[model samples]
Target: MARVRVLMAKPGLDGHDRGVKVVARALRDAGMEVVYTGLHQTPEEIVEAAIQEDVDIVGLSILSGAHMTLIPRVNELLKENGASDIVVIGGGTIPEEDVLALKEGGWAKEIFTPGTPLENIVEWINSHVKSKDN
Candidate 1:
């Protein structure tokens, strides 16, 4: 078995990154290989990084209420680039009503709103992301 690789990124103009950093560190502590793409990445840049890094998961943190816009773009790009197998998860300030739609729309595999435990994120990734090396 191989370690799960996760690419954690903050896309668009969301400059508040403390939460993402916390999650990144948590994921790292949990024995996963984590790549943190610092603030203000475009969707294309994020998708490119995910592909180039050969990550098993792309974890996006956004607080700008742009999930409906950005998540789909990232998802679309991943599909268009033949990388749709990359699991997409997100967090931060997302509305409860949008969660189901985001999941059903195939943009976000999971969306963690405010107050979600770090343990939950780690466990979800552990269960969902298969090691590509397998």
Candidate 2:
């Protein structure tokens, strides 16, 4: 079986990236091919990377409290670019109420707040995401 390919991005002007880096490492360690887009990326850039990389999932990390705006933009751009099938998940300093909205609004497939176990993240992808070839 092929490994799942993930594009991890930090969108907007969020300068705090320690947590994202950690998640990237954890995902990599879990045997998924991880492509991290680094910090301060626009939703367009992120979607472009995800398409170019032929990734199965897009994992966005935002700490700028702009999840409501950024996450939806990324999802919209993905659909506009015809890559809406690429799963978009997020992790950040988002509030609980917004988490529900993001998911309910279809902005994010899943939103992981702080304190979410790395295993849970890996497992979510393992169960939910499949390599495109599969």
Query: TM-scores for all candidates?
Result: 0.98, 0.98
| Total clashes in model 1, counting residue pairs 3 or more apart in sequence or in different chains | 0
lDDT of 1 by residue, 19-119 (tens): 99999999999999999999999999999999999999999999998888998999999999999999999898888878888998888999998888999
Model 2, TM vs. native: 0.98
Q: Worst 10-residue stretch by lDDT in candidate 1? A: 92-101
Pairs that clash in candidate 2: none
What local lDDT does model 2 show for residue 51?
A: 96
lDDT of candidate 2 vs native? 0.94
Clashes of each: 0, 0
lDDT of 2 at 83: 91
Where model 2 places Cα greater than 4 Å from the true spot, the runs are none
